[model samples]
Target: MFELTRYDGRRRVRGSIALSVGLSALAAMVIWVYPSFEAEVDLDQLLAAYPDPILQVMGVQTMTSLGGFLSFELYTFGWVIMLGLYLAYSTAGTIADDVDRGRMDVLLSMPLSRRRLVAERFAAMAVPIVGANLLPPVVVFIGARLIDHPLAATDVLAVHLLSIPYLFACAGIGLLASVVFDRAAIAQRVALGVTFALFLSESLLTGTDAETVGSIAPMRYYDPNAVLLEGHYDLVGAGMLVAMTLAFLVASQLWFGRTDIH
Candidate 1:
């Protein structure tokens, strides 16, 4: 099991490193420029001019502070869209690519059952996602301190730590799509489309009478803005994300186990 996980994880090494570096750099840049923005823009005035729905959609209650700015720009948009898409895109090919390239036969002939094979492959997807999620907080913390706008360390830590489960859920969705679709590229497209659609749905539904509809989307549970800016860590929400992740993984394993790999 460990060997299978290592082999699958090795394929994502370059991508994982690149994503970590990219997001960490972005976090540093966002934090580094806080002073300049604070000096120029009247954030409270500007944010107040916007409607509540607009603010809700943007996942920002305020932009006058470093934490708020980071929540809006880096956490809500950058991490949610960029990291979420990357996870979905990467995981979408984990199973589908092997099956499409006829590599599943050789893999299965190694005395591994389909359940273990799919579970191991799905589990390995966490390596890169978790790696990419970790570096940004360190960079953000350092940059914030340098800029004299240091965020609460616990809040920063909470946001990143809680993000893993949400991202894992997203990857599981993509993994399930990979198993359902025959072509890796097609699976990737499907995963990307669904992930983006859910994001949009959640954003649009927020603050509306139909906000309950957004509950179905994972983004509703994973609010970095709330965690970092308001210091509100939703334990129940995090647990729900974990449940969703497990459900998707189990479904993928069961489906892959019963279906024809070819």
Candidate 2:
């Protein structure tokens, strides 16, 4: 059996350095921009456009002020989901890489079972995906602290807690693609495409006054501003995200088990 967890840890540390760098820059920019204050445009009109049902579905508070912009970092659900998507893009290749290079065949010739190989490959992918998913928020949080404008730490932590499942969702998406496609590049495209669709759905749903549509996107359950900046918690919304992650992950694992890699 492949000692999957140990190999995963080493690769995760090496690959996720890029994730740390990218997110650090993003967090710095966000914090750097925090101080360049300007009056919000047409505050009254914008506030008037606030739709409650969508807000309920998206899990955010309506804000039309400078303060809200600081919290806007969190409200922008697309970015967080995108972060996970990027991690998936960076990862989705463990088994495919081996298979394409003839390494899997060599490894399979050993005592390791096919299922053991899959589990190890998945573990290798998961570690870095988790690290990449986590690094940005921490960098942002630290930047906020340095600037002395660290918004609600507890609330942001709460939001990140919610983000856990979202990251898993991305991983599951990639895993599903991995099983369905024999090629790594194709699986990557599938993962990224699906993630983009989710983001698009959230954008379209939030743009409309309709709560019905927004509820369909997993991203809709999290409003970064409310959870990470404003210190709001939505247990029900978080639950939905976790549930979706579970569904995707279980389905992907089963599919992977049935797949015959040649």
Candidate 3:
């Protein structure tokens, strides 16, 4: 099952790997360094230098230093939203792509269970995800080194540690879509739209009285400010993320198991 599925997966894997690299680079620049430089300029002071209403609209006062970047600021929200988009883009069509290209039957005809086949294909998708999640910290590490700043290895790792489960959850969501939606384009659309909606719900919940909506968006639980800056992790939130990933993975397996690939 693994061999057959991946034989088809290997077809699309290279391009996705390239995309992961691109995502990592873009994330490092937009999410990591943009805030780093914005911090150096004392964006907080500048915001404070302005009036409350103005800063409220511009959304700069929340940041005081490189550390302040972790707050639910625009860039942080942007990063979460953008990464979700990438996750959807990368994982959504992975399985359905093969099927739409008329290859699901070719692979399933071999001595393999559809469940086992989808599982391996799902694992194959993670290689690029790991690369995407890990790459930013490496750049941040190098930047921290160059500036003689503190880069608590644990904290740096904590950010990625906090992030990867969400990635898998998204991947699982995509795979679930793959099994349910016959058209690759439709599957990709469902995953990307749903993930982005989650991102927006979480962001809005960060400021407004929308905690209820937040319960629906997993990213709301991450609290990058506390984890990335305060160096405190919400074990419960992280645990839930893990649980969600497992749930989605199992759901994917079950859905695929019952699916008629023909």
Candidate 4:
């Protein structure tokens, strides 16, 4: 029963480590450069130069402090956008790639049910998602200490902890795509496009009459800036994201169960 989950998870370990290390390195760089950057430029004036909509989209609340700066420069783009897109793209290929390469037939011929196979494959996504979220905070904390920045450990922890469900929700989008499309490339492309479009819609439509439409986007729930800068943790939003992920997973399982492997 757990064999498929363990095998798929092990397959992802190396890539997950690489992703974790790369993000950690980026976080270190961002933390290392903070002091000099703050001294040289007027962050307020800089933030003021951008339009309000642009600032809102970027999650750039304040850049004067390390937490705010990291929230804006690092977490917003690196965590929210890049990591979300990467997971979506990676998971998007999970089922479709096997199906496209005729591997699904072999797997289906085994004792595994279609629903169980889809569930296990999707569960394997936890490897990368957990890796991506785990290592960066350690690096950021050490970097903050070395640089003499008074970053709160609780805030750092909160931001990463809150991001788990959000990342899973993004992966859920890809899981649905992986089951919906027969070709790996098509599933991956569609998943990536849809994820990015959701992000854009959430960013652009906020506070407008159509803002409720963006509620469906996972980005609308996770706010790294709020967690880091303001120490605000939206437990309800995280719960919603968890619910959304389950919804996607169940939908994928149902669709894959009905899909003809041929």
Candidate 5:
């Protein structure tokens, strides 16, 4: 029944592994450099020199501790921005690429309903999202311990767990774009552009008068600093992200079901 899901999920395994390893390597590098960085620079003074907007956008609450450093250097940029964008870019190609290459007609000729196809294809995105989230915490925790900056295991796990919904929400945006555009390249570009714009809006407009406009952005709900540095998991925000994912998924299914393939 879920043949499409299994096929797509299997296809993503190698890429997901490569992504996990690459992120682990980056985490190791960041952890390895912390001691030297701490010795060579005044974190407080350096952070103070940056404008408030820049700090807020980077999710840099502090840089004096290992958790804070990893939060700002690794999770904020690696997980929040890079991983989020990767998923959006990957998911953006799913349906659109199939359509662009005339594979959609072949798939539609099978027993699968449009909704099931969309749902299962979207479900396949979990392979990468979960893989990327699952391995990094172990690496981060071990790297921290090796560097004599042991982190709370629970906090590291919480950060990755919370990121799942955030990543799914990002993929949902790509899914919407995938259905809207027939060309994979065009859909991918649009999805990347929209996701990044949302990220910028959330980062730049938080305390400003236009903050309300940024509330719709999924990035606004996921705060790595809150999880890693403060040990505060935002369950409410995760729930909101899950809701946004479902909304985007439903919207995509509806639009795809009605649209003409040609």
Candidate 6:
């Protein structure tokens, strides 16, 4: 199991490291620029001028503080869209690539069970996502402190810590797609489409009559903006994310267990 996890981890390690470094730099840069915004604009007035839908999509409620700014500029858009899509793309090929290349037969011929194989591969997918999620908060925290904005350490920690299950749920969707489709490209497309669509639905339908529809999206329960900016950690929301992730993983295991990989 550990070997299977390491094998997948090694394949994606370089790319994951690059992404983490890039996000950290970006977070620092974003925090660095916060002072200028504070000096220039009447943020509350500026934010109020935007339509509610735009504000909701942008994830900026109050622009009076550093936490709100970072939540809006860095975590909400960058992590939700960029990191989420990257995970989908990375995991979408995990199972399909092996099957497509005829490596699944050789692996299955060994002592590995199909259920264990899928679980280990999913665990491997978590490595990059967890690493990517962990690095940005440190950069953001240090940058905030350097700029004298001084976000609470607990808020900084909560933002990244709570995001893990969300990323896992996103990866689980891709893993399920990878096993269902024999072609990696097709799996990737499906995963990307589903993930983005869910995000868009959550973004658009939230706080409206159609919120029930949005509730079905995994992204609905994972709001780093709430955690980082408002200091509101939704334990129930985090629990829901965990439940959804487990559901996806179980479905993946069962599906892969019954799959006919030639």
- On lDDT, the leading prediction is 5
Better candidate by TM-score, 2 or 5: 5
True-structure lDDT of candidate 5: 0.93
TM-score of 6: 0.94
Model 1: per-residue Cα lDDT over 1-262, one tens digit each: 4678989889878888888999898888888788998998888888888997778677777788888898888988777777788788889999999989999889889988888888888889878878887688888888888888888999999989988888998898799999999799999999999998989899998778998988878888888878876799999999999999989888988888888866
Candidate 5 least-lDDT 10 residues: 222-231
Better of 2 and 4 by lDDT: 4
Full candidate order by TM-score, most accurate first: 5, 4, 1, 6, 3, 2
lDDT of 4 at 107: 89
Question: What lDDT score goes with residue 152 in model 2?
Answer: 60
93 Cα displacement, candidate 4 (Å): 0.7
Tell me the TM-score of each prediction against the true structure: 0.94, 0.75, 0.79, 0.98, 0.98, 0.94
After best superposition, candidate 3 residue 80: deviation in angstroms? 2.2
For residues 1-262, what per-residue lDDT tens digits would candidate 5 score against the true structure? Answer: 9999999999999999999989989998999999999999999999999999899888788999999998889988998899889999999999999999999999999998999999999999999999987777898999899989899999999999999999999999999999999999999999999999999899999888999999999988888788877789999999999999999999999999999998
**TM match of model 2 to true structure:** 0.75
In model 5, what is the error at residue 16, expressed in angstroms?
A: 0.6
Please list all clashing residue pairs in model 3, or write none if there are none: none
Tens-digit lDDT track of model 4 for 125-172: 999999888889999888899988867899898899898899999999
Which of the two candidates, 1 or 3, achieves a greater lDDT against the reference? 1
Clashing residue pairs in all predictions, respectively, total 0, 4, 0, 0, 0, 0
Cα RMSD to the true fold for all candidates: 1.6, 4.4, 4.1, 0.9, 0.8, 1.5
lDDT of 3 by residue, 46-113 (tens): 66677754443323335644545534442354345566566666677767887788888887777877
Off by over 4 Å in 4: none
- lDDT (CA) per prediction: 0.86, 0.63, 0.66, 0.92, 0.93, 0.85
lDDT of 6 by residue, 22-112 (tens): 9999898888888998999999888888998888776677768888887788887788777788788778898999998889999899898
- Ten-residue region with minimum lDDT total, candidate 3: 52-61
* Model 4 steric clash pairs: none
